[model samples]
Target: MPDDARLLSHPFDDDKLREECGIFGVIGVVDAAQFVALGLHALQHRGQEAGGIVTYAPEVGFASARRFGYVRDSFTKASVIETLPGSLGIGHVRYSTAGSKGQTQIRDVQPLFAEFAMGGCAIAHNGNITNAVALKRELIERGSIFQSSSDTECIIHLMARSIQSNIPERIKDALRRVEGAFSIVAMTRSKLIGVRDPLGVRPLMLGRVGDGFALASETCAFDIIGAEFLREVEPGEMVIITADGVESFFPFERQRPRFCVFEHVYFSRPDSVIGGKSVYETRRRIGVELAREAPVEADLVCPVPDSGTPAAIGYSQESGIPYAMGIIRNQYVGRTFIEPAEHIRNMGVRLKLNVNRALIRGKRIVLVDDSVVRGTTSRKIKEMILDAGAREVHFRIASPPTQWPCFYGVDTPEKDKLLASTMSEEQMRAHLGVDSLRFVSLDGLYRAAGEENGRDDARPQYCDACFSGDYPVSPADMIERGFQLKRSA
Candidate 1:
């Protein structure tokens, strides 16, 4: 594993759910690493800490580049791309959800590679494997030497130990032993492969790029590389692509799909599509549903900026209030802005966001934001709004209150640290010093995501454990470590 060379996350970024990773792969495209880089760039919002790419050409064989920073910073340079020349390639952008958090090692970065008895293979994975600890312990006891602390590395070891003769077959043999969510984009010497876990707790999509096929975490990535969207890799399904065409297989038991509901709320780009619906339209509908469920009279409807803009627009249109950009985001601010000095650290959200004082002064404001986790950022924003002479600040969240910690790859504060876990809506309002705080109900959220009759309590159509505390898959490792499941009613 590469040494911990220090990667800094934005100081204020701690208030939101941290996305796990983004992955992309191509098998038949010329300059395939370039396309993989472009696709990872499009999905950068999912993970920004580090990136890696692996490629294979008959002349060069398996070559890899993993670095601790943005993809644009490293992969864009010809010097770096030149080394990875091939027609088949895969890449990964990572944020630490399953391994070391603030301290990331270069080797911890992905497109993790290994050489098998059959051949060499590289894999990029999203989502957490719930039983990784037990699997790793067993692997170590059985004499499998470990390299990195990542859960994804366990998959490589599992594949190496498989009795299956072929790489794809070994993948099936390996995945069957793991639990929880995973959406993987992997490359064998001649093939590009994609797969989703049994429950479909995360997302993986297949697209067509010229004669070659592309696999990515979202449709937005396909759009970036001029790929035509084909369809989603169904839950429990594996897709193998070569020059000939694409082949699909179901390697796991079928179950009710449990696609992460939060993707519609925050993880995915608004322009992307999931479950055959536009993410932007779904967020807008969330605001519309919120207006009907919790209507408020205010002078202006304003968004917190960026993530909140689409929903604010919907709220304004539904409530007959004009929408305003009350908060301005500093477009140039990068996560690399390190605040080592106390005074600089104290600048906090002000460094990334500022109130449009002229537009905010003396107005009754309704502030729409995506989700509130620890309440630190919300309180800061509220203080900033009030300081700018806003008469009243009402908060409307686009998603249900996140009350439980996510074990399926999202980085979340512990359950006790989550504001919703410890406080009621009224208490949250008081804590943030806002006039009112309202979140879209879980049922309303489902309806916004196109569930006509709302969330089915009998059998949820999506994974909403962060809000509902009804985990679709048992968090086996957490249970062993004394993390209790939600109490039965």
Candidate 2:
């Protein structure tokens, strides 16, 4: 039951940049759909708008259910999972990025299914195809009918028209023609396939459960389902898993991996591991780096809460400043910003966070946070702190200023909307009405992420394109179509 009329994930939260999608797949298990449901639930943080699961069973063939809402609500019902009886399954959790046309369309919700020349296949994609518009035009010219307004559908059309001899070969042919970040999981009647693009801009990890193989966007999914974490699906590599075993192929030429750095800053479960580094550990290290780079003599160090907690702990430990929960988030107030009334929306930060005036009053505070986009959140937070009688407020950001908009997957605001893109540090400080604002340097971030040698100017280890405008994958569609990049990105 795909729901095209489903609502957005609190439009007010659009300011928070989000990962495009999350995928989970499992092969060689009875009730595989259950595993997929649990895995998708664990990955709910990555996407909150919609969830779908596609399962294949000898008795039932392929059964799918896509619904708008949380995975726990959409896929956890016994009646729903019972309908998807299968021994092989793949699931997708999706959140639309900004400019995502027809965002509520159920047809765009995936693991999009298709019947190709090779066989029947269902695909779930985790990254944007930068050249999708161009390829879509070419495919349309050659008479391919597109069912959904999604770039992931382009691969389905490409695979259908390929002259390749097998399903895997056709998939390779399709992937080769695509550009930008992608971590895909697809299922055929008897096989499960996982692929990561050459640069590995997105994350895809392999795992094992009992006698089965699993694939997921994050290790946290594997954790929820009690699976053993295996190595990551390597850059430019694909693994085809059948009942007998798994076979590997590297159809695309390999390149230096430029995994998204923001994954550590805000995405991914804190307990999860990426490239062997603990996400929580990296955040703490980032706080340590921030303390070293910008030491402030403040009465207390307070994190912005939730996303900022781990880094705040690190900053407190490294700088010897006691950390206090000066502002507490009301977990129950999930989407207070959704109030359509202007006065309610104007309430803003107070709706979600309440100032602990007892802890904050008369305190000189160092507020630790992840990143500043439009500075609206920071400005609101600063006003809240001052209203609580804070003597001074200094802002310490964990990552470098976000200047470039993320085209690969994140829903970042355009260049002109980004405060850092237009304002200098001093200007931003005055704009946020803070005594001072300091963002961790790019090299500091690399170091916290375990790039001990610092960033290699010629061959960077990670994609800091949001902070540094060095995009590894060319934004072919956006550039060729004249998507007005700042200073010719």
Candidate 3:
């Protein structure tokens, strides 16, 4: 949004899913914007491209600061934070799902604002609305002038046309017509509000940061600000918080929840809890499940580092292979999933990762990683390991092969671009040049996530559409555009 890409940092491609966004909101606090900043900082892994905060004060009114950079850089500046003064506020950290359609990229930064006939409200949203393009076209046909190309902006346009008398009622009126995943944080003059989609495909939690109430995309934000973890905002629930306390409503037809399974596998912070389970514990157990389902002999179990560390530890403990750091990640390297220009992606793994030849030489090694989207990273790593004199290199992926692209907000490669979409497991192993490659079974993934009896096909406990192609919500936009929306056989 700020046009800083001219600095020539890098382009992107990651062997993992691209995260969408993080949102934080607070009311009943003296420095509401600052608290929101801390919460967004804790949730930074969710989105990192740009951030904005909007606050309201009776003495001043609604004020906002949106910038294209890290939270610490944008929201932490005394000059920036001072401009936004209020006791109730909301904030958002965004990753560009893709490019916007117009020149108002600066306006696209959120917590997006709108002035209603009743009053003005500012909102920040996570997850994609599948019917956004259709809704936007319909809105424009009715003469709605739009400021941003974001799907979230569609919600604002719909709100402007609502006949409702109150902001919350108007919000409900607006959301009723949209479909797909959403977890929103909004600030009216005096209240902070939170909402989760009917299916709860994304995570949003309620907490108490003091006498004041708080809401965030993850519990890690509550931990960061010393808030007490309350509970999740249930599927289809809307919450409005004020000094009076919290009010809840069921604004949509209730359905069996389908929380995103990939959040437990890779997206969420290890310290955060989702649906009563620790993300780190879930990932670690996934590794244990992999060891049980796909046992292999190896000199040492080694992780790709950081995201792969917990699972590798579990694999080593379960299989009795000592774990080692066979690869070192440059901690300073920006996340690869955010880049897309082909030249930078083709530059490969050497930019962000390096092989620890001393740990890998002459020994059979098992490499534990979270997921493999294109097989490029895996192939590159295989070459590096072989060149380093490793006798045998086996790969153990913590999640099932991601054969289908996600339409629920994750920036997955297209179906045709997904390696698993076209290759058999044996074929993938050969292509990556690995002696063997194993992925945790889908049912095993369920077991790891605390579903004791494994997945319930009658009503699966999680959203695993990327693996099973069982989309709970119809991807209407993709379908209308003729992407042939059909489930995998």
Most accurate candidate by TM-score: 1
Q: Largest lDDT belongs to which candidate?
A: 1
Ranking by lDDT: 1, 2, 3
Whole-model Cα lDDT of every candidate shown, in order:
0.90, 0.88, 0.87
The C-alpha RMSD in Å for every predicted model, in order, reads: 2.3, 2.9, 3.0
Q: Flag clash pairs in model 2.
A: none
lDDT of 1 by residue, 1-489 (tens): 111221135565668887789989987889998999999999999998889999999997999999877889989999999999998999999886534445667889998999888899999899999999999999999999998878999999999899999999999999999999999999988988898999999999999999899999999999989999999999999999988899999989999999999999999999999999999999999999888888998999999888998889889999998899999999887765764555675677898899999999999999999999989889999999999999999999999999999989898877888899999999999999999999999999999999989988999999999998999989999999999888999
TM-score, predicted candidate 1 vs. hidden true structure: 0.97
Q: List, in order, the clash count of every candidate structure.
A: 0, 0, 2
- What's model 3's TM-score? 0.94
TM-score of each: 0.97, 0.96, 0.94
List candidate 2 stretches off by more than 4 Å: 1-12, 98-103, 336-342, 484-489
Runs of candidate 3 exceeding 4 Å displacement: 1-13, 100-104, 335-347, 487-489
Candidate 2 per-residue lDDT, tens place, 1-489, comes to 011111124423444667878999999888999999999999998888788999999887899999887887788899999999888999999876532334468888999999766668999999999999999999999999998878999999999888988888889999999998999999999999999999898999999988999999999999998999999999999999998888999999878899999999998989899999999999999999999999999999999988889999999999999999999998876542365566676676787889999999999999999889888888889999999999999999999999988878776676788899999999999999999999999999999999997788789999889998888888888899676654652
Ranking by TM-score: 1, 2, 3
After superposition, which runs of candidate 1 have C-alpha atoms over 4 Å from their true positions?
1-8, 98-102
Evaluate residue 122 in candidate 2 and report its C-alpha lDDT on the 0 to 100 scale.
95
